[model samples]
Target chain A: MNWNQIRTVYGKEMRDALRDRRTLLSMLLVPALVIPGIMFAFTAVSLKVVKKAAEETPAVMIIGPGNSEPLQKALAGSPKLRLVPAASDYAQQISDKRIRAAVEIPPGFEADLAANSIATVKIYTYEGEMKSSFAAGEIDRILREFREAAVTRKLGERGLNASFVRPFEIKRQNVAPPEKVGGNLFGGFVPYLLIILSVVGAMYPAIDLTAGEKERGTMETILCSPVGRVELVLGKFLTVLTISLSTVVTSITSMALSAVGLVHLFAGKVGAGAKAVNAATGQQLPMVDPVGVLGVMVMVLPLAVVFSALLFSVSLFAKSHKEAQTYASPILFLTILPAMAAMLPGVELNAKLALIPVLNVSLIGKEMVSGSFRYDMMALIFGSSCLYGAAALAVAVRLFNRESVLFRT
Target chain B: MIEAEGLTKVFRDKKRVEVRAVDGVSFRVEPGQIYGLLGANGAGKTTTLRLLATLLKPTSGAATVAGFDVVRQAHEVRKQVGFLAASTALYGRLTARETITYFGRLNGLGDPEIAVRTRRLTEELDMGEFIDRRTDKFSTGMKQKVSIARTLIHDPAVMIFDEPTLGLDVLAARTIVRFIRDCRERGKTVIYSTHVMSEVEKLCDVIGIVHGGRIRAEGTLDALRARFGQRDMEEIFVAAVGGESALARQDVPPATTR
Candidate 1:
């Protein structure tokens, strides 16, 4: 009830938390370093590995080179595929990774093709191995080119054009802006990280401010002051919220910078690899909009409060920091499950889902960051989250006032 | 002034068994008087003090501190009372001054007033050297001084000391004993709890001998000696709680065994 007392507690707790190495690690350093660390490893390492795999020429063995001289010649002419001598151990070689893949040309394959008969060419590969997959892909490409050349020759002999085989063309284009494309790509990921970091950021301080006080014998001293239980809880909750928000902000900024740096760094050096990444994401590696980033941060505020209060309440039940951690693990997992639910395909923010606590924030956050704002749903989720936060805070205050809990032995 | 009438506290264990941590206990301590509640550990001494300090509500009966009901006006009672225990500790990350300033603000003191009181307590407790340093590195005596300073920051009228010297070395214990005496000299109503008979004999103006959650005997040290016909304070305490069986189990010196 007393604002000044709450401010005093908040300021003191913030100062104390800032000085604590554990809290600082969770709040600032870990998120800041971890996001960039992960991003750098994910982007740079993956790009290098994929580039190497694509560039490395994998040896291939043709089972029947005599049956298809033109096919064999075309495969040999390709710079990406190296044709090895026919051998009985070609399958063994593929399995042992000595050869990346093997091609089985059926008997009379050229005759069957010239007679317009269907024949299947089997491409043997080491499944799931990157290099073998790349080699198999190269063989498939060369086979398609060989078949296409034969088709064109057959069409010309019949006095037909290449277009005679095709009726119409299918073309596709992305209507959404690049920012939305990036948002759609990273939306689930960014909010997932922010929500998790926010919860984790609140964890240590919530435990320290409540159970740590009990462990250190400062609980009774603080409780003996004129500050009411509500005020005390509010002050501690605000401190936790402040730290949690700082972590969210730090991680968002770190991830944004890392994404931008990685995009620029690899865009030129690994142009083809970058294009592959862009193709995988279905965009040109769009930058996350600054406005959308700010919006996500704003949307995460109420959710942070919910986490802070819940963590504070759960940790207050424990009598020591270690016990508090034990008590808080379930809450962490519980928050994570709902936050991750938003990342699931087809899990969109709806009227029903918006009423849920963490899931709503995540769903709405994903949408908000992707340049979509359903204000009604946003207001609903925000309001519901605020309600949950208030309820959790009330529970924390109630627990703080309970003699059984505060003086638990 | 402080008063209590038939105060009691009951707790339920994990097995659903009711345990009377504090029974019907009554006492009075006027301003400028030191009332010591002498009992062995877990004898409801801490519970009784906690009840009067508004840290815990009583299951029955009532108490008042500095003209405020401990339960209904708990906030006001806390504002007027300073409570400390040997178990109560300092924020290790905070400097002594910050700790004092924090508690002062919690007690509803303004910045200027807190500043003034911090200076006075710092000088009076002789904490000038360590006041600006973090308490995690402080010795027991220094930490206890900081705790005391924090307790007295708002200058409450009533003081509660619950085994404040329990874990201290001789010098630190002496400092606490001196602080209690100073509280009495400043016209503050004080309730001190300890199992140490020497502390009662040396500091208490009135002593309440507590046992099994009840006050078994209440009077001055001289009055208790006269009533029990025992010269030594330990003998007087033994006689007050239980006559001969407790005396056999007690570990006091052989000279005071009789």
Candidate 2:
């Protein structure tokens, strides 16, 4: 293949692709704006919803209120859960969803507590109601605290230490640094989104260059030139590869920047909340490492080439733009399945899994972000993907040379 | 110079049934001459031209352009021949000058040579006014000019035109005819295909009447008129496709370049 001729084809296609409105929108504008915007908005919205849910005061009714004034006082003192008026039929109130939950304190509960006997307090809540569940949890916590207080008082009266009631204490710790922890947490989602966007960005230009050329009657003119079929296919392939790679790069960069900004914003609020417990905990959310970003970009390169070649070959079969779209849409689902495979729990990056295309990239991306490096698996992933890309490119060049495919009616 | 020896093409559909689109067709046109190929629709006129252009390979026989065999030296043959069709499609996003330069570079012309040729072809085709404008908004005639410029960008020794004026207006058709005459004046071999009888009569030095994928008559216009005892070219075409019954069944109206 002549390099000059290939460059000429590449240059012309780039000129055409750059001028296209839809391609510019999908490649530059969408990744630079839509992706980061959507991720940030989604994160912000979900965080706000969770905070609101935690802070909201949901009403609960106390049933059989004649015997437990101390229990009632304890319940009213809880900051998050509010005690409403005792309903005559509190079970009806819980079932009707008017109240989130109701607590039942039997008539002999104070005598039982004075005699140091076991007594049960029943909590009723509607199943599957979020606020109802929250209320139940709050009431359970208050009952536990009241029982603990009684135990401490009884122990002190008997001249025994409160420590005698405890057998052992359990403590948990995480050894991973912030970046690795962040990588492990958000790794699957980030790679999945990046692969999806890369494929999407490559689709329009692939169809435009191959099938679009045929529809426009320019394919004949180009084919009639002195350039070889391989050169033609490579020229178009590189053009598409550039677009797909740029898309992933821009999207990942913007998403990373926005995530950092969001982390800073949320850290302030969370740090204020953390001051009540431990002040340093809120600002420690992990980030994707710079090395991990570079590794992902490299690993995804072959996959992008695969998508570019596959779309080119498939679109070459189509006689028109609409038909090309029909031929190309199924590829999205085909790639989505493997890209999402990394999101599943217990799916590790073993040698066998590394041979898989999109799934391998995703799993390896997760590993890279988590600060795990298996050079053998990375090599296998990269080499196998290169083979796959070459194979697809061969098919594309073959299809391009076939007059039947090129001039199909 | 151009030559063909019983060039044929067979097409098979999904069912594997074969149809001979071009069957043992043969003709020749020397340098400085225009060979007009005449036929009714589906008489293999376009197929024959495509085979000669190396766009479609002949299932049997052989063709050569400027001494290069189409099958063995397709790239060389392509470098020496320029093919044009009636559609005259241009890249809508590319300006006329860019379109010409793109084809020139693809044809292996250097940058300076491509520039020089683009300028010359633009002037020759009368496309200087809209040379820098995108073709999406171009009229049919302006697009045809760009098409002609791109086709001749490499200064190929042979030209192949397949009903290039089929849907063109009179003014545009006249421009193409004049261009074909100029190509021959520059000592370029030309193979022109159309059902327009007057174009063949006025422009072609030699005429080949193709029917059912085979040449039924091969001679100059007067020679065909004398041999077939017919004065009108349409009647000559009717005879070549098997006389009046075939003429009665022609789907496309008889095209006259009057």
Candidate 3:
């Protein structure tokens, strides 16, 4: 096919799409707006909920008369947990609902502790609550610790040590790369967006160029031109791919930007031996290297094209603009199946997944997120998708030229 | 320059009955002449033109347009023919000049040649100023002029126009009639379809009246009038297409006439 003719058709359709303000806005502006908009809203709401939960939890009141000094110190050092000492107004405070929970200790608590007799601490709290239940559970936990310490001290007084009761403490330090750190957060839905976008992007131009042209009554005029049928179909198919690719790129960009934002939002809630930001300077601490993100972008491209072409082929089966839309709707769900399958947490990225479109992309994206670049699997995904895209594009063109498809009207 | 021999097309679906849109239709048109296919809506005038344009292939028989078979050499047929159906079928988003240039490119013309032809057509059609404006924003007459410019872009040897003057004002219709006349003057063959008898009388060198999948009459106006024993072409056309039943019955007392 002459590239000039293809360019002519492509230029005209692109101009047409641009002229349609609504369609143009739907394509570029929607993605630009929707991703950040949704992310911002969710972030604001999440922060609000967390802050509210912290605020609503009643302060922990320590009522131990003696031998519970260590327990009081632990509660005092926790910045997140508020510490309130038992007072004369404690009874009135409980009755007035001023406190969600309180721990009450008996007078001979220290004597019972030294004798090693069974000692119980009274804990008071409200019934049937949300965060208050966790608060109440925390109060009981401290009371249990105080009792254990008293028993340990009593054993010491009896000329024996509590070492036989327990072994040494256990500690684990995770040294995964920054990208992997982010992946551990979801390991679920983050990668699926790429697959969704490529399919959506591929579908828009196919339906618009084929069915849309028919609806506008321009297809007949186009067919009458001396332009070859193959050229016409290819021009339209390319437009759909371009649209789908742009969407995929935009979604990925949005995802990356959001990832950056989320990384900063969770600056303190992460591991060490890596530079953690103080949340003061917006400067990134280089948690995940730039190479990993680039790898993810490369990995997503092939899968994007494969699914995009699949959508293109399915859309070509439509006889009219309306029929094309109906033909395209079901394929949206089809993409979701692979997305769901790829979402099993702790699943490993492997070469066996290279044959699957959505699953392969998700795996590769996962690997990229974790700062692991598998060039071979990356090549397999991109090569297979490009091959699939070319095949799908050919089928779409053939369907377009078939007398049975375009001439049905 | 253009001919159809026993051309036929059958349309079918799973449940509905089959439709013979065109049946054994035959006709011929030499260069430097206007051949009018006159028929009512759905009378197969447009279908016959589409078949000749190679937009749709004939189910049987043969059509050779500009020395190219409409079936075996369909692309060649398209290369030589400029087809315009009743539908304006213009891309709403493209400017008139861009629309013409796009078709020129499709015809495989070089950029400079496309530019030259587009400029010449725009000036000849008296659409130079409006040509740069988006066609969707054009009036019916302006749009009709652009559509004409589109068909003329490839400079084909044969022009197939199906109801070219449809929904056109008097002035627009005049321009189209003049364009067809110009095509004939340039020795280009044209297969024109219209239901307007005056258009046929004034411009067509030959006329074919099609009805119910058949050509009811084909000849010069004089020949048709002589055959019907009527001087008026409209009266001949009325009598030719089984006549209008109401007018036919009203022309005589039913029982006595029977």
TM-score of every candidate relative to the true structure: 0.94, 0.93, 0.83
Q: What's the lDDT for all of these models?
A: 0.86, 0.85, 0.73
After superposition, the stretches of candidate 2 with alpha carbons farther than 4 Å from their true spots are: A88-98, A106-108, A111-120, A124-134, A153-161, A261-267, A270-284, B247-258
lDDT (Cα, tens digit) per residue for candidate 1, span A1-409: 6788888888999999999999889877876897799889987887788778877889999999898988888889989888889999988898898999999999999899989999999999999999998888889999998888888999999999988886587767778887787777777776777788888889889999999999998888888888888888898899999988888878777877887788687768667766786786566766456676677777778888988999999899899999999989998899889888888878877899989888888887787778778899888988898898888888988998898888886
The alpha-carbon deviation from the true structure for residue A158 of candidate 3, after best TM-score superposition, in angstroms, is 3.5
Question: Which ranges of candidate 1 are over 4 A from the true structure?
Answer: A155-164, A270-272, A275-283, B244-258
DockQ of 1: 0.52
Decreasing lDDT order of the candidates: 1, 2, 3
lDDT of 2 by residue, B19-47 (tens): 67788887789999999998877778888
Superposed by TM-score, candidate 3 places the C-alpha of residue A245 at a distance from the truth, in angstroms, of 2.1
Q: Supply DockQ values for each candidate.
A: 0.52, 0.52, 0.38
How close is each model in CA RMSD to the real structure?
3.8, 3.4, 6.5
Largest lDDT belongs to which candidate?
Answer: 1
Point out the worst 10-residue segment of candidate 3 chain B by lDDT.
B249-258
lDDT of model 3 at position B155 = 84
Kindly report which residue pairs in candidate 1 clash with one another: none
Model 3 C-alpha lDDT per residue in residues A1-409, reported as the tens digit of each score: 6788788788887777768775556567777778877877786686666557656646756676454555567566655456676786765676666665666666666566556576677676666654556577776666667657765876777787777555576655555654566655544355676667767766767677777776777877888777777777667666666777677677667757876786587555432212333243333333443565566556666666665556666655555668887888888887788777777776666777787767777777766665667788888888886787678667767776666566664
Better of 2 and 3 by lDDT: 2
